[model samples]
Target: MIYSSEHFSISLLQPKDALQLNKLLVSNTERFIRFLPKTLEENTTLESTQYYIKRKIKSAKKRNEFVFIIHDKHSIDIIGMIILKNLDWKIKKGEFAYCIGKRFKGKGLMSKAIKATTNYVIEELGLETLQILSHKTNLSSVNTALGSGFEWQATLKDEFKPLNKAPLDMELFEFSRPDRF
Candidate 1:
């Protein structure tokens, strides 16, 4: 599914995007690690990124997860990525996660992308509820969640432990599909 906004678009990461994703990750290593250390640690090279993308494709084909890459509308550059994961088919629930390149920070691109993806999954994929987990210290992420209509559901104690750091509390935000009928 491709979702287009005024300045950016979100779509599945094609195999051709591996190299660009690698470069983007390398350049934003510091910023990314601040929020997404594990993701950065895994996709440290073009080969690893290709492997990750392949895995995403497999998961997508199986209808287990969906990963979307955010691109600059004009340049088509890879600027960020989002995932709808940990889907529970019986309850129609999924967790969402996302990260943006440092250069793309403060552009409101992620908020737009999040809102678009959340709507797509709920409306098109028949997901009943979506959740976003963000570290309490990450105000930008919290803002993005709230801006995209996700309400604060709870504070999960020690939900995430960043590398070499004490376990940090995480805020759980959720959005439920509105009654349409």
Candidate 2:
């Protein structure tokens, strides 16, 4: 089922969306890589992306991971994507990740999307804590996490090495279920 709100709708990524998804990733690769691992943008091909998305959808079903596309209601254009992965039912925790197209930045679209997606993760998926990891250099991502109610956590030193880049520090953030607040 699609999750809808006044500003945007979150829906499962489908096979038919392959072309559009590829275009979205290609167009936003530079902006996306600033916060994500650089390897995601490097060596990306439509076919490989298609394969990856298809696998994510299947994995979402099996592992309770949810991958959603954030779309503008009026324009029907995809603005971003959010992923909840590694759902551990015993711990009631999951890893959260997201990317918004450059064109849609600073419009509060991602904050809305995060609110909607987190609601689903909590109400529908029964998750308690959402963990978000981002590069220290990406302030926008850090802002998004904070805006979405994630608390700042300690930084991990030299935890990740982006493709073709030196090891970098990563900031770990956490947002708990409202009841935990």
Candidate 3:
């Protein structure tokens, strides 16, 4: 799927995107560590990042999962990525995850990318619901969810624990079919 907004374009990730994706992932390590465990931080080598990209592309082809990279049309720089995974056709549901390069945050790029991705998933893929889970303390993530029309669902206490850190609460949010408008 390919989508374009005024500032960015959202398109299916390609195998050739591995190198750029790896660089972005590594550069944004600090931001990613906010949600992921420290072990993840330590394991984010270029090889591991390449492995992840390959897996995502493969899974997208096999399971109707869609992963897209956000890029500036002019510069063609990768700014972020969004993934719609774990698609359940029977229930028409899927989980959404996204991350923006630290340099691209606060520019409204995320909201635009999400809106474009959600539209494609709902209209093209026929998904009826989308779920987003984030750490409670990640205010930017929570705000992004709400901004994209996801409603507060519930909180799961001590749902995740980063290596050497205390367990953290997770907030669940959902955007139903009707919420698109």
Candidate 2 lDDT tens digits, 40-130: 6532787877887777778887977777888777775778888887688998999888988888888877877787788888888788999
For model 3 the TM-score comes to 0.86
Worst lDDT window (10 residues) for model 2? Answer: 34-43
**TM-score winner among the candidates?**
1
lDDT of 1: 0.86
Best by lDDT: 1
- What are the lDDT scores of the predictions, listed in order? 0.86, 0.78, 0.78
Kindly indicate the candidate among 1 and 2 with the higher TM-score. 1
- CA deviation > 4 Å runs, candidate 3: 36-47, 179-181
Any idea what lDDT model 3 has?
A: 0.78
